[model samples]
Target chain A: MSKEEKRLEILTAAMRIMHQEGFEGFKMEDIAKEAGVGKGTIYEYFESKNDLFLEMLRFSTEQFITGLENSLATGTDLESKISNLSLFGSKFLSSHLNLVNSNISHLSLPEDSKDQIKRYWEHIYKTIESELAKAIEGGEIKPHIDLKMAASVIIGSLNQYAFKKLYGTGLPPEQIDHQAIARMILQGMQK
Target chain B: MSKEEKRLEILTAAMRIMHQEGFEGFKMEDIAKEAGVGKGTIYEYFESKNDLFLEMLRFSTEQFITGLENSLATGTDLESKISNLSLFGSKFLSSHLNLVNSNISHLSLPEDSKDQIKRYWEHIYKTIESELAKAIEGGEIKPHIDLKMAASVIIGSLNQYAFKKLYGTGLPPEQIDHQAIARMILQGMQK
Candidate 1:
């Protein structure tokens, strides 16, 4: 494999370990074996297990943004488009992504990692913001409201609900009424 | 002071250190000195720094719930009531509370801590749910809507926005225009 490809392979191994074992369960020696690389080779690429984990987080975030772009494009209108976004959120929460994010928070984040987090957030917010702007022009929603605030409402509502479900309600991902959630965000709580 | 009161003093000291220096900066001796207790006394109350921090978290959560109950009760109508809630959320995000929550997330949460988190969420969600029920009765919002979902939507929207602003947009709590946010949740994005 090319040098870059080899690095990618190691990250994938790390991700699997994280999913199966969680943050606390991650073991560098196990990751080296899983990646089919010598333990020394693993160190050559990553300074520490924490470094590899940070890289993996950045990689996954990039993947999420890319995948979101494709799924969002498949929606036929503002309503369906947003519903797709909400469903993706459900799927995201169901995965190890949220857990990983929370687990990494206590780490003394490096400046680059902080910047990456900022970028990840901005990238997602813009995707939602653009969707809202499109809906405005298409008359799916009124143009009078603040687009940023509107976007925040939709994002925050879905984000918190998904997070709470991880512990509070314990709903299965397949059983989540994502369409209703999207509708609620679009239409508000009014009758 | 009573044993319970003495423990509370140590937790408060720990919170101060966390705010000043974050999790990495927390020093047991520093807290003991701040609380006007011997290091031995701290051990008598809590087994370890992690144990002490967890107790501090739970203590703060309880305080939050009690304070919220009072502020939420002050609003005379549904609009004001919900606005009060959102504003409280803004103040909360701006405080050390959100920072403390994130900084502690990676900790291997004990069962008692897990239960505490669940209780905190349920407590908050119920508060919002009760407000919505009253609004429904007052005809401020439609009774046709699913109350639980509606509450989730409101909570999630405010939550994500506050969290993102912590890094994504960097809006000050006072400058957040929370009434508009509350209105958007009540009226939605649809014109």
Candidate 2:
């Protein structure tokens, strides 16, 4: 098999194992066995188990960003762009709840790894920020609204909802009725 | 000292140590030393480390609930009551960001312990729900607004914002301006 394809296969297997067994429980030997690769073969691609797991997260997030950018590019107006983005986010969140939950959000990491995660988050936020700025410029939203705070609120609220789904069970997720929640947040509940 | 006073002192010391070093780093020996009690005396007060830690959370949250209830009781109108409750919530969240960051929201405990936490949260929500219901009945809110969803949205959104604060660096929180956020949520940004 091609090296790139083999690497992808290993990553997929790693994610599955990590999701089921958690970060601390994951072992490189088990992953190699699960992926049908020689133990040394994993070392050829990744320096350590930490690298393999984090790279999997990076790969998934990069794909998500690319999908988001493509979706946003299709819409002209800020409203439609944001609408599409939030819908995409909702579906993405529901589909990858396991990945999101598996992210060791609390664990301390090596400096370089920590920086990579920070940059990834910053890039995503900047993309959202620009969209918000466009909406404000287009007069779709109130002129004086703090775009940063609004963006933070939007991102924070949705992420929190997703976090709640991961940790607890209550609110029906976006997959069940995307339009209802999208509508509720976009337009305040007041009459 | 009296039994209740000694128990209170132990819990206070436990909280201080846990907040500084986290649950994993929270050693029984340190707690006993901080509380000025023999290691065995800790068992006299609480059966185990997990039991002591969970009680620490319950003690703080109960104090928070009592403070909020006092604020709510002072107001007659639904809007005023909600406003007071929401403000108290924002303040409480800012103070307890670390506790939430530690995943206290999703803490897994034994059945009775879990039930105690659940009852505490339910009671908090129940207070707000009934107050909102009364407001709807009194026509304080718009006649058509869904009080249940509205209550959830308010509580959920505020808690979500507080959770976000723990994830990223921002203005030193003193300048976070929850008052302004409360204003926007209660009254829209629209002119």
lDDT of 2 at B84: 63
lDDT by residue for model 1 (A1-191), tens: 89999999999888777766655567888888889998889888888876887888788888778757875798988777777767777677666445333223334577788777777767877887887788889888998778777777776676566666644567876677778877888788866
Put down candidate 2 lDDT per residue, A66-177, tens digits, no spaces: 8678757877755456456656665665444234321234344566776677677668768877876777777766777765456555554444444434334554444333
Every candidate's DockQ is 0.54, 0.23
Candidate 1's clash total is: 5
TM-score of 2: 0.71
**Residue pairs with backbone overlap in model 1:** A142-B191, A156-B156, A156-B157, A157-B156, A157-B157
Candidate 1 regions with alpha-carbon error over 4 angstroms = A1-6, A16-23, A26-39, A99-107, B1-5, B19-39, B99-107
lDDT of 1 by residue, B1-191 (tens): 78888877888888777665555567888888888888888899998876887787887777667656866798887667667777776676556545323223334567787677767767777987888888888888887787778877876677666666654567777777767777888888886
DockQ, 0 to 1 scale, candidate 2: 0.23
lDDT over C-alpha atoms for residue B149 of model 1: 81
